[model samples]
Target chain A: MNKRILFAVIITVILCGLAQAKTTITWWQFWTDPNIKPVIEKMVTEFEQANPDIDIQLTDLTWANGHEKIVIAFGSKTGPDIVELGSDWIAEFAANNLLMDMSTQVASDSADYEGWGMATYDGKVFARPWILGTRVLFANRDLLTQAGYKENFIPLTFEQLNEATKKIQALSPSIYGWGSNAPEKHRLYKKFLPFFWSHGAKLFSDDGSMCLLASDSSIKALKVYKELHDSCGFVADQRGIEDAFLEGKIGFIISGDWLLKRIELENRKINLLSSFIPGTKLLGKSFQGGEFLAVNTASKHPREAMRFIQFITSPENQVKFCVANRSANPSSLEAQKDDYFSSSIHLQTFIRQIKFANHPPVDPDWVYIEQAIEEAVENALFRSGLVAHSLYEARKKIEKIKAQ
Target chain B: MKWSKAGALALALPWLLTFGIFWLFPIIYSFIIGFTDQQLLAADTQWVGFDNYRALLSDPDFLKSLKNTFIFVLGTIPLTTVIALGMALLIDKQFPGRGLFRSGFFLPSITSMVVIALIFTNLYQRGGYIALLSEMIGLSPPEHGFLYSGETALFSIMAMDVWMAVGYYMLIFLAGLKSIPRELYESAEINGAGKIRQFFSITLPLLKPVALFILVVNSIKSFQVFVEIFVMTKGKFETSTMVYFIYETGLTTKFEFGYASAAAYVLFVIIGVFALAQFLLFRRKQVAW
Candidate 1:
């Protein structure tokens, strides 16, 4: 009887040890929407259940302060095991050695993801593209009809867009024809980049060693943007523009797919349609922006973090999360072909637009470059500077940055 | 006695340690960092000496921000001081529902600045209440909203700041008024001095220290104006203040910590100079008194 008791006690001790040995992976993400938070929580729960030996701890961050918080955390060497970063932010983090290189893990299938380029630096992948957020042209169909355009008409070129905006502006003195964002740093550049891309303007040379901001195509793009602004008499930030469009005060706006999801959720009454951004030669090309998932360099449970990333970014799970959010497109190619995407014509346009989307250069100095572009745009649009002169000055500044 | 002194130090050790660790250490470290090329996320920082400061001297954006900050400070301080003093004098008198008036004036001071800024943002938007009122009064408002226009954005924010800040300063003035001996006013009245003469002779002269205090404090606050511009204009439309520029450089733009620190030190020096000048001026006046 004494021997039996001893064995039972030993067995209990081993079981408790196993339970206590569970690896906890802490993940910090910035999707704080009520609708999306639950989906993430559910996924975490599911992940924990499937891998019972791994405990997933989740922390939500607000978009406004999330990047700063992450920087502080990493700078203080107290970051979580995993983090969700904006695609634009990955370069800075990876350059600082704050992120773990996941190149080996993602190498087998990185091409299958839409925004993996943003997560790569020095030929090493540091993060996984979790979502592909691309903006398309959103038109108030009623306003378009009022402007004498045929029902379901979408502008295919800058000229067509300008003509439609002129007609729309004539419809009512209060109604604006085009909704353009203000020339704010970090924001205005993204709005204007799509125009450059559509005009076949190269921001950098083939080797990425030189800036081409003053190229003829680039100047042409700026002229077109200025023309649109002057014609439409619309000047506001993206949020203001969206609000105006929702209120039927604007006829045309270029915005993210999330706006469509918001309109649906709000059950807004306006007749709205989505199309690729108007292009000069090609169909509307846009700047590809998205979120990425990365493991912190300081994480002790790197393997567990990697497992979590893999689980969350699997094609099926990607579809599940994107369908739940209804705001972002899936990064996974297979997921993009899922029923949820195929069933909606609006979402289909976004998928097609994503094919032509290009990301900003993956340089750690991208923030400075973005500021330079914004300043140039602001000078051209608001200040008393010629577009060519502004672009030239911006190019010189960008060249200095690149040289550094 | 030495034992007692040691005991007192022991009792204060927690606060001393906290101050040293959280405040003094960061201030010193940041001063050191200001001499380096310390991007927040960069793995390596280089000691660049005075390069950041030298660069700032030639930076057009920094110069513009400095100018805007000065404008904000100059525009808001005297207005806030005078208005607050007036309000304090009015409410200091014996009257019905004086307490109610005090609370009403103090309400905005205690309210969250973020909420107030958001409300003001809407009011300054195109076709919002303020724009509508301006049009109704036959004044031509900016077509794209006050906040959107470079000419009107900073001034609009300045007006809001003055409105938001005057109430708090008024409370300070009220405190100063309460401390004054009623006998002086009564004696002046007995001398056949009118109310204006009593105010100019007794009230203004007696409130010198308090007025100086308000001026110094309000100037410091105005110089550091950030949240209003952040929430409303996002530092666009030429409304960026020095503090906003520091914040954007340090956190938002490129995480150029060293550059931001240099800018911050410049602002700190400016504020320190102003404070010293105010102190000297107040001391000279006190001597005259």
Candidate 2:
């Protein structure tokens, strides 16, 4: 009896140790959307289930906090085993040497991953493209109708939008014809980026030498932006876009699909429609504002981490991510063709916009420049009360940054 | 023989070492970086000498932010001092519900500034209550509260800060007021001094130390105002302050540690000069008695 009990005790100890044996992976992310959280949690669970030897912990932080937190973490050499980086963050993080080159891991089978090139730096891949969605004009058709604009009056060009806005303002029933956030960097930059690019303006000069903000095309783009603000009634704060649209007071908003679930949740009787915003000088230009999954250079289990990223980016799993979160599919050639995504009519507009995204200027200076430019632009508008001064001032500020 | 000094030093060693390694090194290192062309990821940093300082001297944004910081500090400190003293005097009374009122006053200061800024943002929105109230009163209320107006945005933030801080500062004043001997006031009454005269002669004179202490602390904190502008207008609407400028310069873009470090050192010097001037002026008054 004593011998048997000893053997059982030894067996139990071994089993317990096996249960505890796992490579713990730390992932930091910020997904506040109610739909997004569960989808991600499910993905994490499935990844864990498949690899019982690998344990993964997920943390959810807000967007603004996440930006600061990730930067601090990387600077301190204690970020995460993997992190979800916003598309805008690529330039900043890539510039800092915080991200690892994923090239070696995927070089053997690089074709398996699609658009992973988005995270490339100096010809080396760092992160896998996670999701793809673009900025679009959200037209509340009911609001348009109330404002005496036709249902099809969603403008096909910047000129058309202005014209439509003027018409709506004339017969408006407390409903403005158009609205866009002037002070928002992420939103405005993305919306204006395409216009600036298509209008033969490079936001940054070739070889990334100067801000080129004084370039004539950029000035024209700024003028167009000012016109949007002056012609379309701009709500001072962001909530004006979401609230006024819900109340059917705003005809159009330059926003993304991030608002879709909220609109559905509110259950407002207004007709919410999404479409590609017409370009000022070219085919509709949009920005892909999505997160990327990059493995930590400090990760103890790089092979396993890389494999996880690969598995997740697979067409099979990406569908899981997008469908569960109600987000656009990641920029995967395979994922784009998935019947589940292609058949979804509501998602088509976002999907179609994927091609037009002017790959963001990949420079280490973007995060700081973004903040400086945003502040400069807003001050020029609200403080100096002049667009030319604001853009020029913004250009000068960016120039100082670039020269550094 | 000097065990007390040794003991104190021993106890302080932990904090001293912590501050030395963490704060001192960074401060000095950043100052050195200020003299060079500092870039985080780049290995090369050519020495730039005083050029960064020279450029900063002429930078409008830097000057604007500095000006904004001073305006915010000036706008809040006096009002906070007087209002806090008034509240402290009221709370020192044995009046009914005094405890509740004290707690209520301290409530906003206890709440996070981020939450307050967020709530304030909503309040300042168009057709929001604050805006509506201004309109109803026939005021040319900035349609976006004070945040949208170039003329009033900075002051508006200062006003919110003062409102948030008065309660906290009041508690400090209340403590100082309580510590004062009641016998002194009684003697003043016996001497036939009026309430106003008694206040001027005793209360104001006695509260000098506390007032000076509050002024120094408030000035230092207000000088470093970043989050309010960062959150409210993101340093937009003419509300950008010195610290926010430092943040944008240093950590945010290209990590221009050199330029940002220069800006920071300038800020330190400005604060030091102000504090020193105040000390010299106040010390000459010889009011310790």
Candidate 3:
């Protein structure tokens, strides 16, 4: 009887020890949408099942307040092991040295994912890109045809777009040509920069020491944008503009992939078309932004966190996530060729635009620089018709930001 | 009834603790941080006494925000005070469904500002009801509607603020009106005073205290306008008020805590000055009356 009791005690001790051996890694993610939340949960559950020695704890975040929460968490040193960061926010955190250096860990697999420019800081990778997307010109083919254009009208050049919008505006007193963004900071820049870039306007010079916004190309681009705003543009916030488009009130709206999901969910029956942004020469360079995964410096379980990042960002898992998300594409190069993304025409347009899209300059001062660009756009749209003057002021502001 | 000092201290401890932790500490800490170069996420902070204040004095954005805040305060206060007073007078009359009218007027004040701002944003959109009404009246609205136009964005928000806030102040004026002695109006009527004359001589004078209180409170509230701008225009189209500027600098765009704190202190001073001036002006007018 004594020998049997001792054996039971030994087994209990071993079981307790084995349970304690499993490492728990906390992941803070921003996939709160009903459709995608389950996919994330399933993936995490599968990951834990596959790796018996690991446990995953997931926390949800919203796009509206996630950045502030993450900043406060890091400031207080209570951040989660793994965090999902917006592509633009990575540079700011990495510059502050708040992110763990994943250079050695991700070095081998870095080339597999796209948008590394946003995740790398000072020649070192700090985060892994997970999902990539870009803005596309969402048009109403019926509206174009009603305005006496071809049934499948898609503007190939800036002049064509301008004329198309004018013709569409002439269709009725209520109908509008374009859905232009109002002077909202952090957002208006995305709308204006595409026009500027398509005209070959580089934000900074080749050496990256001086502002190039005052160049001729930039002024020309601003003029095009100003004309759009003046002619038949239905100026409003992003949601308002998209709603107008969904209601078939506007001719064309430069919007993001999320609109596709919105259309599907709302079950809007309209003659819809998605195409590349109209450009001056080649196709316009739309804004590329995405989500990235990183291990916080405050994380106690860095190894486990890195492992989880790898598991979630694997090509197969990324494709599954993209399929669930319905709008965003997988960052994985291999996953980009998946049938799910290729099967949808709307996703195909976004994929092509993503290839041509340009991520804003990856710098610590990008937040401030983008504000300056936004102000310039606002000045051109509302304050004055002198696009050159607006560009000049923006260049001066950018110079000051760089100096600081 | 007398109480022991320890007992009293124990009773007050919860309030005192919360006050110190949430209010007093942040106030003092933010004031101190105003003189330093503290980034929200940066590990290190350095003292730069007077630099932030000096920079703000020359900052165009800061100046514009200050100007906008002042315009908001000045533009809304008189209009809101008169409209609320007029509303209170109408509601105070012995009329049918007076209680229903009072509740109807007070409903908007109780509603969330964010909800109202969002509703107003839609109402001010191009081809929205406002634009349609403008067309109906043959007074052509701006091409891009109200909120989207630089000329009308701030004014549109100001109009909404007044409409939402008038109800609360009207209730206050109603309370003030009820408190006035009925005997005084009886005496005025007996003296052969006309209704208009009695109102100006009796009601206006008696309502002085409430007016002063509302003016000071409204000035402070209007000067700190943020939610409407944040929701409607996002400080765009020259609608960046002082509070919105500080929020953008410290929390949203730049995360320059020190600069935002300095801007906040400046706003604090401005509000203090305005409040004091209103107090003095009201006191002198009371003496004249």
The estimated TM-scores of all candidates read 0.93, 0.84, 0.95
Model 3, span A273-352: residue lDDT tens: 89998898667888888999999887888988998899999999988888777855689999998998888898999888
What is the Å distance of residue A162 in model 1 from its true position? 0.9
Output the better candidate (2/3) by TM-score: 3
Weakest 10 consecutive residues of candidate 2 chain A by summed lDDT: A376-385
In candidate 1, which residue ranges exceed 4 Å CA deviation? A1-20, B1-3, B92-100, B177-198, B287-289
Task: Supply the TM-score of chain A against the true chain A for every candidate structure.
Answer: 0.95, 0.88, 0.95
lDDT of 2 at B26: 94
Root-mean-square deviation per candidate: 2.8, 5.0, 2.4
Q: List the residue pairs that clash in candidate 1.
A: none
Q: Tens-digit lDDT track for model 2 on A34-82?
A: 7667877877888899888888888877865677677667766788988
Please state the CAPRI-style docking class of candidate 3: medium
**Which ten-residue region of model 2 chain B has the weakest summed lDDT?**
B280-289
User: Model 2 misses residue A366 by how many Å?
Assistant: 2.4
Ranking by TM-score: 3, 1, 2
What's the best-to-worst order under DockQ? Answer: 3, 1, 2
lDDT of 1 by residue, A1-404 (tens): 99999999999999999877889899999878888889999999999999999999899999878888998888878899999999888998898888999989888887787787888898899999888888888888998887778895888888898898889999988999989888765679888999999999998999887789999999999999988887785788888789889999998888888887778899988888888888995585798989899999989989889999999999988988888789458999888888898778888888888888888988888988898999888888876579999999999999988887
Q: Which candidate is the best by lDDT?
A: 3
